[model samples]
Target: MQRNASKPWLGALSALAMLSATAAAAQDKITIGLLEDVSGDIALMGAPKLNGTLLAVEEINNSGGIMGRQIEIKHLDPQMDNARYQEFARRLIKRDKVDVLIGGITSASREAIRPIVNRSDVFYFYTNQYEGGVCDASMVSTGAVPEQQFSTLIPWMVEKFGKKVYIIAADYNFGQLSAVWTRDILGKLGGEVIGEEFIPLGVSQFGQTIQNIQKAKPDWIMTLNVGAAQDSFFEQAAAAKLDIPMGSSIKIMLGFEHKRFAPPALANMHAVANWFEEVDTPAATDFKKRWRAKFPDEKYINDMGYNAYVTVYMYKMLVEAAQSTAKEDLRKVIATGEACIEAPEGRICIDPKSQHTSHHMRLISVDDKHNVSVTKDFGLIEPYWLGEVGCDLTQHDPKEQYDPNNLPKK
Candidate 1:
């Protein structure tokens, strides 16, 4: 059979039409640049975070999406590398043209990409518990910060555990700064840090560190260990049978270390958290059930995962309230209104002035069988660190993370 030249020309025209249609369809959807560390030292938390974001995006798309526009997420794994975070942030902004940005497990990673988003005028959501005091018009931190966690945790530890404690934190901006907050809060609570240690990520063995803690023999241990390798500290402590009561700001909540490690590993482990899989609220139970139905293999829904899930819905609320996804409009809604959401963990409200979420915190512990239960409830703590220190995003966009070292004195 002989093909006609006219037919060949018709096929080329059809292909061109299809390309144009695809581009138009993409333009109709709102884009989200999702950066997560699905691999490397922080994968334990990052992989779960990506899963939660995907789940929320799917639900949002199914429910008519944000402002009638479907969400199209452009995901990139930074692998816990700061350089990769910067490169990926730039690519997502310049190439993908995403309407919003979300991710960053560590404070270092947040600082790495925050400037890029600020310069590009992109809205950003950081959904992990961190050292507080980030003030920026282009961002909202929905995670529990030191003000929410340490304020309640330190006092509880001092009241129950003892007045003397040992702190083992990771050697990074988050861990180091969290350590500082712990010291400050504990000191205020009339407690003292008898021994302090900072461990680098990917250090599994804790022989020397365990010896140090044993020698110090404080009332209890405050474990700020982060990442997968550092999780081994729980196992080592168990093996050595360091039966001393321990408290933390992260231990069981962010990493779900109790569920991952063997029984008795986290026997005496206690931590302050905004939410956990076992929170038992009707919303929390439904969320856990649905997540398990979708991801049958997932072990536990940690705090980071819940934060990612809630932050996505928070973005939806902001878009619908503002009637637009433009950065300026969203900023206006956040700046003008006390934005609140009924998440799995009760009510979470945005502190408009500080650009952080007020969290419902609790002190929880795990038994030898790895069962977690709330020991005490500290209801709805507003993120007060930035506001108390004079960093108000509504008044000015400083574009800086205020820590103990660089805080402005009122």
Candidate 2:
């Protein structure tokens, strides 16, 4: 009887030890939250962004992940609704407790969760080309800023295409700020702005705006619209036969959005972009080869999707460099402006002051074959809005400048 009792005790002890080992192994996994618009207006961009994030995570995990722990991402679709964005952000912070967050294809979605991120003290990496003037200690802007996109593109347009300009943009923070900077820069370059118009978001019919552009007959038309609205505007302009040359801060040719709507009529429209996968560079060629192998059907990867992939790898580098997932330490490392990602556009880095990324911007034009092609390379542009606009970011804390409902009024 004593021998049998002793045997049972030993077996129970061994079971407990095995369970503890399994628990330790599970705890080693690192979690990241990928919040994006996968089901709404910007779904075209969002779907690819999600896929790119997944591809990056897969590559990292396959290589043994960060410090022997696999990286796990929780994908959440906010559906492009502002309220849904806030809710999912709360889930990421409270429920999932993700080590970091990545997403935001649209400026409106990014702005919606900006305050929530600040309040929770989470590191949110936003990947999209947008208007500048955003500096936050907790947030890292990894996309092309106004300096990277507009500053170079606008000046090049003025010189190359003659500078009597007309501006038509979506009526929002991104659009408003883009128009403001365009007007400011054009004036500095001895150019005249003949007309400026703002349209409400999601307004499909652009008949009135097309008429206005035709009547004004500006030397160049600069646009800042996005999503379906941009498609609609271009379609209407083509139908009306308004032939003024158009330039955009957003790269319309980088994705299928323009292909499905604008078609041959969109041929010759110019855009400023950070990267084009087709351009033959060592970095771009390597990326294209790997990407094509992975996705045989996909002909081209859009800029936003490419940025999403880059952001994931950038976060991995930061996590490994810091050797800790503590939000404060990670934030400091990102804000230092020295970190860079191996992107198709070559090495891209963030400017410490503005917290905006600096990368090579390419001027792309739609060709007669209905395919987008790179026309010119502007090379690398540094982030310097304070010098350009005379507004200092160093004087004030980013936290102090952040107001949830009240964005900078134009």
Candidate 3:
């Protein structure tokens, strides 16, 4: 009986030792929670974003990792479900305890998980071009906003196309808010939105919408369609021989619609954004070469993917600058406006006041051959709307995204 009791005690000791070792190993890694759509309505764009994130972690780890600790990524596909975003965000913060949370392809998804991150004090990085007006210290937005996108495109559209415009966008916060910005810019430019329609993300058909555009006979159509629902509009427009010029904020760059759809469909499309795959720079070229080397079988990398890639590196830079992974220290470092990185797009820096990034923007026009050309470069445009509307995260973080409708007039 004594011998058997001693054997059980020995087994318990072995189990305790294993548990201790596991805990020690866990301390040797920094984890990032990547919440993206891998297989759903948004996967066409989200997959590239996921690849960018995974690639960054691999590179960081291969180069001896962050602070000599390896990067561990907990990538959960939300399948384009907002509810899943909330659920996974909770899981990441409470259960897995990720060091940082990165990924939210759309403004809807970002807003869905924003509150959860704010409450938990988990550092979040929203790596996609959005409708702007987010003011939060708990998170940093590292993508183009309406100001960066429209400042050049709208003026050029009005100059080349005409003063009359038709608006078509995905029916979400992103689309709705972006439309507001469009009207604001166009109104100032002595242009007008003659007709408009908000299409659901699942609805790819555009027969009636195209007819409305034809009836309106606007100078240009502002096409902000996203995801799988995008291709059909271009195809249907071509079949109808609409032949009108199109001006947009979120067009070919993210979805690569210019590449996906056949010629002339996107020939008249002009997109203004922060990053496009065709953007040529020494930094961008090297980045593409490395991305190709890793993802040889990968399709086109869009703006969202490039933003994710830059943000991951930015996070590493901030963490190292703070010399700690604590959220408090990171916030202090970011508030200094030193949380900047030389990205594929160029030197992108966070505005110490608004917690929004200033982007290197471009106006890219697609040709009949589906080739993209940089028509103009709007170098390092600051996010004007949020700061213009009293968002100063350094002193006071409202921890909320303000609606354009409710904002104070400039």
* lDDT, candidate 2, 227-280, per-residue tens: 665567777787778877778877563455456664656765788888655577
List all candidate RMSDs to the true structure.
3.3, 5.0, 2.2
- Give one digit per residue, the lDDT tens place, for model 3 in 1-410: 78768699787888999989988887899999989898987788898999999888889999999889899999999988899999999999999988899988878889999989989878999998888888888888888888888867899999998999999998899889889888988999889999989988889888999999999999999988876865589999998999999988888888888888878889878999888889888988899999999999778878988888888898999899998888889888977877788888888888877778889988999889989999988788987677778887777877767765776333
> Which residue pairs in candidate 2 collide?
none
Position 25, candidate 1: lDDT: 87
TM-score of each: 0.93, 0.87, 0.95
The parts of candidate 3 lying over 4 Å away from their true place are 1-20, 408-410
What candidate 1 gets wrong by more than 4 Å, as runs, is: 1-23
How does candidate 3 fare on TM-score? 0.95
Residue 257 in model 3: lDDT:
87
Estimate the overall C-alpha local distance difference test score of candidate 3. Answer: 0.86
**Could you give the candidate ranking by TM-score, starting with the highest?**
3, 1, 2
The candidate scoring highest on TM-score is 3
When summed lDDT is taken over every stretch of 10 residues in candidate 3, the lowest stretch is: 401-410
lDDT to native, each model: 0.87, 0.76, 0.86
What lDDT is reached at residue 264 by model 1? Answer: 91
